[model samples]
Target: MGFADYPFTSRYQTIDGHRLHYIDEGQGPTLLFLHGNPTSSYLWRNVIKPLRDRYRCVAPDLIGFGRSDKPELDYRFLTHYHYIREFVAALDLKDVTLVLHDWGGPIGFRLAQQEPRRVARLCFMETFPFTFDWEEFPLAARPLFFAFRRQRLSYWLLQRHNLFVDLVLRLSTFRPLPRSVMAAYRAPFPDARSRYPIRVFPGELPINDRDTEAHRAIEEIERGLAGMPQPMLLLHFHPGAVLGRSRVAWLAQRLPDLEVVDGGRGLHYVPEDRPERIAEALEDWLRRRLPEPVRGALPAARVAAEDDRFGGALTWTFADTEHGGMVAAWSSHGLVMLSFAEDVDDGRAQLARRFPKASLEAADQGAIANLLAAPAATPLHLVGTPFQRAVWRALLEIPPGQTRHYGELAHALRSQARAVGSAVGSNRIALLVPCHRVVPRAGGLGGYHWGVARKKALLAAEGVKEP
Candidate 1:
């Protein structure tokens, strides 16, 4: 097997009287791999190897693909979705980042919609999440769709000849796969009876038709993108197989929080062509957003879906505001810094000065704004003296529409008022830790590190009058 160098643990779950097989390896939060037609979890070997150090990798053979049971049941999109959903539930996979491709897009996204709490982030490639009419289909891809829908032809080709694994993937992939790799792909379905899932995927695609369940799945994805939001990344090649230039743009418009990246010159099977690129993108996004690998089991009963926004480390994002511009950052570590009214470069520089040696990345403006607008429950990573950290924590306890004086805070911490003021000024992260809630004991508003005017505006926004 190709996985000799990167051996993975074999795991299985019985779902719907079929033995669904999957590979579970590594440690920390799970990264679930969902394969499309003709390919199994074996498609993700390259991707899993690189990221196993930081992530727990779970790649499943979707009942009819790899080592999983290929039941005689009709393998429809809904059937696959149910199997995958039950698989996730059975394993209790939480705080998940779905790495999806091909049919996996509809299956994964639809699952996210059904169980909104289960998924945290999504990474997709060559997978369409929106519905399209026949006219919208690419001219080159049109024939393939027509061919797939021809039931007798598709069945003979897919089930009898295994044309998809033998020919289609070979043609779409950028480079020729090794003989061993091809064997791995074909290993599961040596005969027609074993290829039912692959046989079902193509016809299930909603082309020029709306009534199809798969079509409804795409529409559901559209609604899911609108109603609920999470970090998403769309990966595509230059001359795309599925997501051409116009289609990517359409997807961008639909998913405003999406992070777009090029997966180089590849066709639909991006995992085969650009595994490293996908790995790098996943690493960069997960590192910035996740910040740290999960060190231990999450406390019991804490549903991973609960804090799906970003991990507990300090994650930062850049945005433009009426007040010049903003470089807002957060992580599992709460709002570390919000440097407003500064040029992007200057803001990042200021952040560097405040927390030197911290990893920072420029996040999508729209995505960061959504997070900042509705702050998540994350602990602050305050790099200050014990007294200063205590002061910041106390300030966070201050209710909105109320203000605390330096003397009052000092009395609470049993420290000098001057020292408390100095600590407040030293507080690097703003808004989240609520340093602005601390005011002066005298009959005047105290100075603020960001600015007195901004401070006043914050107090006003919180419905607090300077007392």
Candidate 2:
């Protein structure tokens, strides 16, 4: 369908002297959509229309695309990010649920990271942060990106010819893009000069440290992901050009609260191919998180064969401790995380990062509170690999008063000591998982995920004091 076929209100704001266009429809909590290369707010035509009645849905054309003013400036990844940050600020958006694809992922991620309070929920479709060694690229596509370094030839394909609209987009999308939609996509870049942003995008694919800004942002995004408590939803498609099966799984594994829904027979342009499924995926997740009562107009339709509607919910309680306070969290499976620190926020942040989609709340005033008040023995649901799980079980085997060095557990598991140390570092259940019991063989405590002083206190409480 053409942009006109799916109608909505079009709005613009002068962000940094340049007018940026966006689709702003519906009302109530804001749901912001960010587009990538060769596409603009038009990409979200199908997604925004369906949920406009109950929610204020927005799809913005990045500076160079759609009706936005295409300024003649060096368009780097950071440049796009600054514009997006300014767009959100200019509108003074609050409690935003971000729907991001392609370049939008990194741009939106950095914005959310810097201002966590403004953003509440996120939906990632056919996207990955720019990090990792060049060798880590998916085997099928490595050659394509590797060859993109030949800037002269790549620039010809991007600027001289309408390769993205005429060839790449058509190839990437599953559904046929009729003449009208093609005309809409081609409408922006009437000539080579306006397509400079597209020219820079391909070569700017952050491989290794080559794209320094992207590389640093990737590292920070990956690192910050482990701390960001926002609930995330991922739409995993069959064949994205770069984001393949392995990349999707790796991302899902890291975010404790990420729910993955299958986008059938779709590629990198999954948004174009499967907009109905995409809308449903966001709608289903928002139903659970939306504070207001679910309205009738926003009907919940189940999307795809693989339903990822459930996850990232945690039942937690806080109790006063001698050192400070402890937060105990439990999943439906069992007691999953136990943590002691100065306040409950540390544990909450950890659980939020680990189970990004899980609901976290205070335990009722009863036995649950008693459990949080003290380290009540409960069956643990460990979060890790087989080796990590085995290492944690080994730690649990240690008598409360006794301690084991990293080497001792490694030898017992018949694995490398570093592997044991890594697992110890990742332990979620803390005292119950008993990772604090594992220490350095040399002398002083090796490390603790919580704190060295807390580790010492736990050890001292059990009879073995920290060196």
Highest-scoring model, lDDT: 1
Number of the top TM-score candidate:
1
Q: RMSD of each candidate?
A: 15.1, 11.7
TM-score of every model versus the real structure: 0.67, 0.63
Q: Residue by residue across 237-289, what tens digits does model 1's lDDT show? A: 86767788888887776663467887788888888888889999888867644
With candidate 2 superimposed using the best TM-score fit, by how many Å does residue 357's alpha carbon deviate from the native? 29
TM-score of 1: 0.67
Q: How does model 1 fare in lDDT?
A: 0.74
Candidate 2, residues 1-467, lDDT tens digits: the string is 44347586778999879999887898866899998888998888888878888889988899898999998767888888888889888898866889999888888888878876577668888766647666666575556556555677666777788676777787777788878888888999989888878777766666764747666776788778755545677888886665777887787667644667776778788878888889887898777545421111111111100012226456887666555666777655567666664666776776667666667777763534555455444545554433455566687788888988888876765445665787788776766667888888899987988788778888998899675
The Cα error of candidate 1 at residue 192, in Å, is 1.6
- Residue 12 in candidate 1 has what lDDT? 86
Question: How far off is residue 181 in model 1, in Å?
Answer: 1.2
